[model samples]
Target: MERSQPNYRLIYHDIISIKCPGKKEECSPILNKKEISILDVIKLNMIIFGINDKETQIFNQKHRSYDESTILEILDYQAKNNLNNTQLANHFKLSRNTVAKWKKHFKNKHLHPVKAN
Candidate 1:
């Protein structure tokens, strides 16, 4: 279901967060399943969303060096989905600048698999 407020719905997790006790500013953690650990929670999402396991691991993950393969992956997904920079950024929970940078990179070159040393 589409939400009027996207912040209220944890679409990726398929569960909404309540307020943390006494913490008005912060929402509570997700509780749709018994997650023994963070890794387990990621695994659950992977199965539930039917997406690549890597995407599940990094869906909310941010602030790390993006490799060429990952960049190409985003480029391909954007093209396939016909998503603009704003749409891609919102969908991926990334900054608009990041999406713009990637989009430019994609337009400027061909995505080729490279051997890592």
Candidate 2:
């Protein structure tokens, strides 16, 4: 079994599982599901943004799928403006993973403002 780091439950899980007898295995399938698929994530994002079926277009012509590379710039822009992913996602009505995909694209160190000599 792959044990998650300590405090993972405290920090990440918002719901507590109430296991009942043999249902232990299925008690919290969301946790067991682990990785989320890209397509499902996109659909969730569309719903979050309220685009649904009404919107034919997704991304703008200037850019493509929120590719890993371009997402870095978006993350930096969000951080430089002192916005957390959750806040930005809520404000923009985007999914946390969609915002997180961009955040994961770049390590934080490189984004820091270089100090003048």
Candidate 3:
């Protein structure tokens, strides 16, 4: 079965008609049919809903990067609980390689505190 594309004209009308809360001016300009694309509608919807992909990605990455204290906590949990790399990764929502890398770094830091460079 073929899927029907969304009605861009109706979407454009709805978007242009939306009134900004507590403001008298129109929400946005009425775009010409030739000027509006699917991407433009998607961006307009995102703006209306306050959903920003770029900001979401930055927030996600910031939380994903483990801090020194978090790394130590992971190491301590692994050692005390006898969890394997895969288990630790699953429990913490991290990749197996990340878990292994943290374990290696923890060991290296304790064994060799001073680095040449």
Q: Top model by TM-score, which number? A: 1
Candidate 1: regions farther than 4 A off? 1-62, 110-117
RMSD vs true structure, all candidates:
14.8, 14.3, 16.8
Candidate 1's residue-wise lDDT over 1-117, tens digit each?
Answer: 853323322443334223222332222244344332333344444444446566654755664445555567666667777777677667766777986676666665645422211
lDDT of 2 by residue, 4-117 (tens): 433422322332333233333433443345553333334333433435452444343123345443455555556666777777666555667777655554566346532211
TM-score of each: 0.41, 0.35, 0.40
lDDT score of model 2? Answer: 0.46
**Local distance difference test values of all predictions, in order:** 0.50, 0.46, 0.56
TM-score of 1: 0.41
For this target, which candidate reaches the highest lDDT against the unseen true structure?
A: 3
Better of 2 and 3 by TM-score: 3
TM-score of 2: 0.35
Clashing pairs in 2: none
Write the residue-wise lDDT of candidate 3 on 7-37 in tens digits: 7666655654574332212324424445544
